[model samples]
Target chain A: MNFLEEVILKEGQALSDQVLKVDSFLNHQIDPQVMQKVGQEFARLYRSEGITKVLTIESSGIAPSVMAGLELGVPVVFARKRKSLTQNGDLLTAKVYSFTKEEENEISVSKKWLKAGEKVLVIDDFLAHGEAALGLANLVEEAGAEVAGFGIVIEKSFQSGREKLLKKGYRVESLARVASLSNGSITFTRNGQEAWSL
Target chain B: MNFLEEVILKEGQALSDQVLKVDSFLNHQIDPQVMQKVGQEFARLYRSEGITKVLTIESSGIAPSVMAGLELGVPVVFARKRKSLTQNGDLLTAKVYSFTKEEENEISVSKKWLKAGEKVLVIDDFLAHGEAALGLANLVEEAGAEVAGFGIVIEKSFQSGREKLLKKGYRVESLARVASLSNGSITFTRNGQEAWSL
Candidate 1:
């Protein structure tokens, strides 16, 4: 299995039947080496997309966004989660819901950073609900930029996040995808160990 | 004068007499190229300190912490600012007062990531009020770890944050120190232009 898939299987905790807590390494307690490699993998995956920038939200997504930006050699712009944003120039905004926090927030980006015709790669840690990625994609579209694709660290495929995104005709790639979480056992989509090793 | 100092002098804005907004490159909107250089400088400064890990708070500090971790080739752990953290083992927490946000938050780190006797290099984006850095240092200490030093991207030297950290006998280094902010002009600690070119 790839290092990321292996790490998730070995270190990720299945809390209850609905949650996969990877805070020990992927999100809360970060392993920079592993995160950097994740970025490199994303960069390799999106190398031909002609991505001009990497975009994400604050907090958890910052590390992976920075690493991917460094690997892609592009500036990274993160949308700040705010209660509200006054209508202003050069600002693109959208509403997003946080499944983990169970709260909705307004995410926005300035017009100066994201320009017309620029291709953006959205990088985020989790894809449970896909609201965050969708919000960011909306922001890019509002800025008149094209979303090259999305790079997510972990995707809960049991949820409709990926299917929704795919139905909308957006390209989405995830490093480690969980197909099902039954009782305490977690099943990954890419089950074969070799699927991860390469 | 350092490269970061130069960029601050050129791009940093003085919103009020007490605030120097560096959203153009540091926090809100990040310049990865510049941040990578800042990390290199910090890595060079603390090369002999025998630092085992890098520590910082979440949100703004994540990018710089990750970059610094990459340069130092160490793991980076961030403290999460929550209204409360359920008292539990495998967690080291501290109370930090935010002068800007006008609130107090309980920041915690997983004990699994920080170990007793390990030297930690604290990296942050700013040193305003020093509470964040000091709070992170407290987390390290609570984990029974040692603080190697603090590497800050910007220090509001006009405030008491740096002074407070210094009084505690902590080795604190800042890439850009704002000596004074009068009207709309900012005077950097490194006054000469050559200070930045170096």
Candidate 2:
């Protein structure tokens, strides 16, 4: 977590102190060794959860989620944001509202991948408004699988994602929790760190 | 490579005997253990290539590509299919026609991640038309990076991807090559395997 925080401080771009962009290390451009560590941290957190599958959204979530799956000795099932030509089957679909994209995307997972009674651990890179996590939980339920828990690399605590999931009775773990990103600065809740400007 | 070949024979779904669906383990629902083997295989193959980075596209390629990145101790930079909200920078773009989607998509990579003179190893899940690999190669060149080679998990040998890359003078390595997928039967180039039906 400290390493991740340090990397965020160094490489992550803060957009107007409101949006944290990690394209350099987390999402678009990836450091798989660091991602391996993130996955190991998640595995350590959910060691006794009996996780069978690691669920995530397509594109950005695949890296950290798959890393967690490898560490947990589980398979990773990512919900496709759009139906592709090669993807043909009965799918579990859920509507996810992205605050950043300002739209609703119906993400889907093939029914063949997530089976009934399987325990799923949802993983993603960032948790902002909890839409993706909730949507993935919906997909898990549609597959007749149970949501074991959720693992997130970064959490914007000023946003209501964590609180929403916790209110929904889901155990959510985020490695880096940001208290506020106001006025071109980032503040952490637990570490009680100074507000670092971009 | 034999392990991958065996897995393709065992779990890979034969769609119309022409389209091989590896959603069970490779792409949709990923078996990270198998992907680890895939990463190891790539590392073993490109041991002397001095690969500084692993390049892949979004969606399916992230898993094996990042696995290879972790194994090879390099960063994985995946090309984004669409420009997102946070992505605001100069990009190296390439046009890829998806034979599956029946459309052309312009994939872009940030100019920051891929720099001049870096050794890049391209990785992907499937190679059918070779558009993705070719487009990635173009992006690499645009970034002034050299494409060390390309690594594919599965190759539809009946298709033109392999021959095209070979013609382009790129060293391509496919873990499993299906020579024919006629009449719902899959014949491997190396193993001379059975023709499976969905």
Per-residue lDDT for B84-194 in model 1, tens only? 778988788899998887988999988888899999999888898888888999988888899998999888889998989989999988888888889899887753433
TM-scores of all candidate predictions against the true structure: 0.91, 0.92
Q: In model 1, which residue pairs have backbone atoms overlapping below 3 Å?
A: A1-A193, A1-A196, A1-A197, A2-A196, A2-A197, A90-A111, B1-B195, B1-B196
Docking class of 1: medium
CAPRI docking class of candidate 2: high
Can you give the DockQ of every candidate in the order shown? 0.71, 0.82
* Lowest lDDT block of 10, candidate 2 chain B: B189-198
Tens-place lDDT digits, model 2, residues B1-198: 367777887887678756898888877899999888888888888979999999999889999999899889999999988533244559888888888868888888889889999999999998998999999999999989999999998999989999899999999888888888777666678645432211
Please give, for residues A125-162, the per-residue lDDT of candidate 1 as tens digits. Answer: 98987888889989999889999998999999888888
Leading candidate by TM-score: 2
Model 2: chain B TM-score vs. truth?
0.91
lDDT of 2 by residue, A1-198 (tens): 377777877887678656988898788899998898888888988989999999998788998988899889999998889533244468888888878867778889889888999999999888988999999999898888999999998899888898889999999888888777777677666545532212
